[model samples]
Target: MYSYKERSHIFNTLNSYAFDVLVIGGGITGAGIALDAASRGLSVALVEMQDFAAGTSSRSTKLVHGGLRYLKQFEVGLVADVGREREIVYENAVHVTKPEWMLLPIYKEGSLGSVTTSVALRLYDRLANVRKDERRKMLSKKETLDKVPFLKTEGLKGAGYYVEYKTDDARLTMEVIKKAVEYKAVCINYARVTDFVYKKKKIVAATVKDEISGDTITIHAHQIVNATGAWIEDVQALDQAQKKKQLRLTKGIHIVIDQSVLPLEQAVYFDTEDERMVFAIPRDGKTYVGTTDTFFEDDPINPTATSEDVEYLIEAINFIFPEQNVVAQHVESTWAGVRPLIYEDGKNPSEISRKDEIWTSKSGLMTIAGGKLTGYRKMAEEIVDKIVKKNRFKHATNCITQVLALSGAKGLNSKNFEDYIKNKAKVGESLGFSYEDAKALTAKYGTNVDDVFIHAKNHSADLNLPLALYAELSYSIEKEMAYTPSDFFIRRTGMLYFDIATVEQYKSAVVDLMSNTIGYSDTEKLIYQTQLDLFIDDAKNPK
Candidate 1:
């Protein structure tokens, strides 16, 4: 029922009516909170400064598992909590959240030994309530090498195979927003909360400015939840009644490379020279190896991956798999995100706890911070529970998101995904495309593939990439909130990381599709093209 006109209508009505809850920050946490509160029959309005998941949500290492490394830190509660939640998340978005096997390569002098890793995997499986399908297995050196031929055998002892889930973090965040919309929540991206509206020294509402259209408006709410992740401190500063503490920001960077370059059947988890863990995850026909954790005090909005960070990842990857020797040239794209860990005296970034803490000011402005992706739903439930208790709402029900199916998640099963693609391709053949192209398109769009076919029929015929028909681009703009080519390529279709050359080659055609579908003018299209080019340049020569 949500459309472009409906979105505009809700935006206009936000200021007119006092909402039951106004959630700030449109990251996964904010989106989850909105969906949770709205599904409980509470009127909700959620606002974001940029696009949905434009912040830390999209910049994650893109894993949805219990922190395997946390076991090293002896954070048993945190690991168990995340493990239990991972199952709930996987069930909710079966298509986007699939089980992936992670191999922890045990070197002779590595931080963790084969015996220790085997025991830990057993403990993890028990704690996570891991089903038979996702049980862990221990592998000998020969078995490990057979699974991952790239692994260096010089210092290998064995490997621990454990279950983990991978996800499109951006798409998952957006799907949460879509579900919130279905539950009748008013959600608007590109809207910034400037100042808190106060009534007799108590926070009552917020003054917001639309970043895109430059329009200002005021939205009234009984309670405001600031779930801005790294920016929580900044939002909290607006409340003079509360004490402001500096948040510890840690930069985590990931480098993408073609899977064929270092093809591994499973994700590789290995210990770096510094004793910290690093992951090489296979994703979308590419491999994402990363995440160097370093303290950062720079701009959190646009944190850039330094050359040193990339070098560190390359060194760690090459150290684990000497045969591959992954160098700078092997990297296709690199991205960095800031983790807003609560500052603790004399503690390093790696030692910081991943547990979330909720803070409420005397004026009743609630802020939630310092959680990972797996616990977002739990965080949302706790936030809403506090709101109901604070407001003394008598009719609020207990959280139901535990069983709620996100949009497009209903009737989803892994067994039928292939069949669904074939059916979509058969339909796509009617719209001037080969079976191969149709298969590709259907795999990307799922049940929504029909929308793309309709778009191709209505739009111009000479579309670039017969596989990427006009309909898919139009569907992205109209339904997925894809305002720019980067939004489509980077997040929507995942072409930015998967096939960088294809994105560059079809830039003009994509711009034309955006213009025709989203009502972008020629001047606006040119501007978007320039922005995309600069983004590509930045990806090439990351700051």
Candidate 2:
């Protein structure tokens, strides 16, 4: 359905149709809106300046968490809403999201005492409507150390363990957009909205620039919503609609270390000296710890970890796990993401609330800004609800996304995902793949693994790549619209961060394969090669 080869066709479709709703931005929020509006039978078109989830969505902490820290800020309502949405998101995309039990170590001199933490977690469970099996548990100091032996022994009290949902953020965005495509929503990345056309002081159409083809086209739409995360102000400026409540951009960076260096078995959420919280999570064969929150005023695109940000996280890791003696050299790779919080006077970056607000301009340009990844579905529902009520569309139905299964998740739920993956792996083994590799593939692609297997069986030998890697790369290009090497390495497969060795060894081969497959011109091939090398360098050295 969605393919890089069909981008030109999609652009032509965008130009010819008069859409009912146009969403600007291809991040999680825009993807969610497209899915919602299209499922409701409204003609929808979405355009993104870069690849889908290339911004904050790809560089997140990779969790659909309920924001347990918000409880400290007394934002109970916000926590409750997002916490409940976590189940809905996980149920809809079982492959991309999983329940990860988080350990919150208690300290004698820490801000949260055992008694207070117990009360807070109990309240959190009640507010989130947590499942009985996944409820919180109080672990004794010995048991806590058994779970994480490297934690500091000086101020050890105990731990409160609870469940948090870990997600593949970029993959989740791709699946949502693919599902939107199933509903006939026309969405394209690498398309920028240059300027808007208005009649009678109401926003009606927009002139868009295709980043790849060097062509400009105008798309007519009745209503347009701006959902770009950190670039919200930039879009607002294009419309000359600067309001009082603005966005305060904050940068957060995460550093990854090989499991050989950290050897962390369990995920730990610990307190730092400055009273800030940091998470050390183990995924695949690496342990990643983050993130340092500080004010940012630079470009949001390709934001890299600074020396100070890297040092801050290193210090926090050394403080919590003092025995590890983790130095800057141990950091394998790093990523930095920018958060667009509502500007609050006299508040620090970490102190800003993570609440969302919807603003409609005089020209009827609606904008939604400042929400968490956990609440994207609900946020989309709220925006579409407003649009339907304002337009008085009698045919539009209420939100059904709460029960909708995303692409690759049909007939699969949390209760049966384990069995589904196990059975799917057998099919891969029959197709001449190792069970371990097959199982990993099934977990990553869900029901779509069959397509990947077919690609591997047909083309792996000719492509000169590993069976699994070739399958994934081919599937991404043909089915997921992955155009560049960075799109595949960084977002599609996450090998850039988790397994840098694979990226370094196969970079040139991948470029050659893509150049041949997609017919990249010489100039385009050189540019893409340089861009991917820079990203790999940035991940290793930071900036």
Candidate 3:
């Protein structure tokens, strides 16, 4: 396990060593590429401007399955390939990713009827190579009602149940980074690449700036892989002469609401008024409802959910449930992410492919864009294979990520996680937490829960808040690359989405926790509080 000091040392070491490969962007794809390259005995370095998964990677609907909506569009190959890869991802990260039953409600006038949905589920099951225990099932109206009583019964039709996996997207990305570090890859967040280092017209290195301390350095590498999600075009635009037209950006928005307000026991997948499918997945004692797909014109990195987006989701949920209509108040938090799809002419954004494309520039810069989360590993393998073949480097071995366990994912079965928490609590009484908190933390961090617990135990005297703990916040700063308050609240622990009130109530605690770590003076803390207050006000009254 690498500590904070050790991670700092590793970052310093990367600056000194001329790396074999340098990866820009700490999203899942970049992390995956770094792991794939390093596990093959190549020196690697990964840098990110913000925290890992701060972009589209963290703001997803958190599903790790073949996209069922693609089936409607007849994207057979893409759907099948993603389905096949999901099995591998689930196996590799069993702790954070697990099988989930998805219920697709069939409405009378919906785009997909019961019979079509059943056939689709069957095909999905076959393509995914689902185990017998995790096969798809067709349910009658009464049976569906038994599973989800809140579902609008006016549809008067059956439903289809299919197996998929759900995961904490941010935690999964962090684990990928941790695994890459364990494989000896130098990974640093808060480090932004400002420009490419060109040696006589061929890209050779990159000038990076540390976002925290304003330190700048140039790191040399044999090859540079740009895996920045929505920022790919920005990076490619650096070399205006060699720019190739690729990457279409699509905006996706999701809203989080309390599960008790909706009270659906099973995950629901249904068509909305616009004929697009939306998911209501139950996660961490709350339900995530979202994902409106549309073209966005603003900045991709910092997307805010509009009133129109929230209205779309609220209307969709109300249309489905009818009896228990959800409103804006039901929404605790909202987030938006951009999909970096490959640009194709005359195709709708939704119709554009989710398949990844790797483009090598004339200057020998490789850029990967346009892929779903489920296919990240396979995408990484493909890109690395291309790099190795292009460089004529001796292939030491085949891709081992299939059988390789991610960091802290070893010996993790569903049954032992609770026991793992109990054992940790025994080491110090202050480490004791509610079953929900313990389970959530363990699922998010895997074996890293001990690090947070140890920090909490050491600072028990100063930090004893039930909702927010200083130790957990410090652990996030030290281990999880949490720099901003939003990183800690939104991605690190999911407090922003799970419980908005909890976040508001513990505002001071959060500020206090991060004050010393980030050197936020009293005036800066007040400014942060004002910003958060304005944000809450906007959420309450969106123009």
Candidate 4:
């Protein structure tokens, strides 16, 4: 309900208030910080240069599980904390996060032997406080192939079965920001912080320009936090802070192929010949595999999957699943994301740890860098606690987000999401959605589906678009603050990655609706149109 529609009164309120906290990024880190600070009774203001999650947040591998591979690096505590948080994240956002059993097939020459995987998983379960029934189990060679029939049978001693959480990364960020807004936090998209506003050489506020309207405003705050992922150094340059610590950027690319091409039934995490690990998981009628960790020396904002990147992943997929002869031509879509990790000497991208660190500049600006998606909440809690102690704030309360559900997850939990959807989908069917569509929408939006249902009903007659498409588009415009066609197609609905055809089918109609809804100038309309076209081309060609 905390809509960020263009020209909304939220902007006026943001320009007028000096909040307790001002977050400079709208990625998952900033979104989590906003929710934690606001829920702790602090007034918070957050601004993003692009749509929320447009950076590393949306382009991640989309898993919320503990970095089990970190065990190789002896990062035991990180594994324990993140592993435990996996359940917490899933419980709070059941609609967007769910448990998937992952199969780890052991080969004779692989990095993980049968005994090592079992012992490691057992340690992981105990440290993660896994429920009794969900503990890791050792599957024999026969049992492993039974679960994953396509796994390379040669030298496959056995497999380890364990639970991991799958999620929609962008939707998870959006829902978290929405919940923060519910707690009275003010957030706006497409607003870039051009400079810092300092008094007596201490940072006090920021100079922000609306990326859409081209109007500028100065936002004052008691404390400022920098959570800009990948671009943290850019914000640090604004602060003129030099430190011994720095961020090392690496690029990871993923490719999506239809099930008819890969047909991966089980989520497999296998090692490549070079000792690098990759995941091939099935989602939304497609089997998407990826993540090549190579040093990147390009723009962090829009990292593209080069032909070499595509070739490396294609080789990995074919190596593990010898039966599926997938090639670059079979790739339906691709996405590239950059990870900003703390600089570690002599360590390659994959060798670096995923742990996060918070550093305070002399100007009182706090910058956080080098964290994984699964550890966002804890990272926020740590940063906010530092702010409270340094500022001597009193209105703050304890962290309530551990138990507090996100926007649509309120009044629902992992145990009841299925039943809630079963009952609520009938309501969507009544509003002209087919039963399957109703169930699908209800599953994606959780309790918020009811609001979308209401919006769809109001637009039943006049729209020339599909009813399902209309409901989603209308809801995104009016309720989600999506002002551009790219926002609607890419972040709001995730059609760009999961279902690119739908985006291609509805691009013109969606663009026209948004242009009219937002009152875009003819020139602005062309810009938005070109933006959508660029995104479509990038999704397919990747560069």
Determine which window of 10 residues in candidate 2 has minimal summed lDDT.
Answer: 236-245
Q: How accurate is candidate 4 locally (lDDT)?
A: 0.88
Per-residue error at 98 for model 3, in Å? Answer: 2.1
The C-alpha stretches of model 2 lying farther than 4 A from their native spots are: 240-244, 460-462
Highest-scoring model, TM-score: 2
Clashes of each: 0, 0, 0, 0
Please report, in order, the local distance difference test score of every candidate based on alpha carbons: 0.83, 0.92, 0.80, 0.88
Worst 10 residues of 4 by lDDT: 1-10
* TM-score-sorted candidate list, best first: 2, 4, 1, 3
Model 2: per-residue lDDT, tens digit, 1-543? Answer: 688899999999999989999999999999999999999988999999999999999988999999999999999999999999999999999999999999999999999999999999999999999999989999999999999998899989999999999999999999999999999999999999999898987778989999999899999998899999999888888785444358899999999998898999899999999999999999998999998899999999889998789999999999999999999999989999999999999999888999899989988889999999999999999999999886546678888899999999999998899999899899999998889999999999899889988878566465667888888998999999999999999889989988998999989989998999999999999999999999999999976
Give TM per candidate.
0.95, 0.99, 0.93, 0.98
Query: RMSD to the native, candidate 4?
Result: 1.4
Residue pairs in clash, model 4: none
Q: Which residue runs of candidate 3 sit more than 4 Å off their true CA positions?
A: 1-11, 414-431, 434-436, 461-464, 518-543
Best model per lDDT: 2
Looking at model 1, residue 119 earns an lDDT score of 87
Which is the better candidate, 1 or 3, if ranked by lDDT? 1
Residue 384 Cα positional deviation in candidate 2, in Å, after optimal superposition: 0.6
2 or 4, which is superior by lDDT?
A: 2
**Residues 164-209, candidate 1, lDDT per residue (tens digit)?**
9998888788778988988889888778999998898889999999
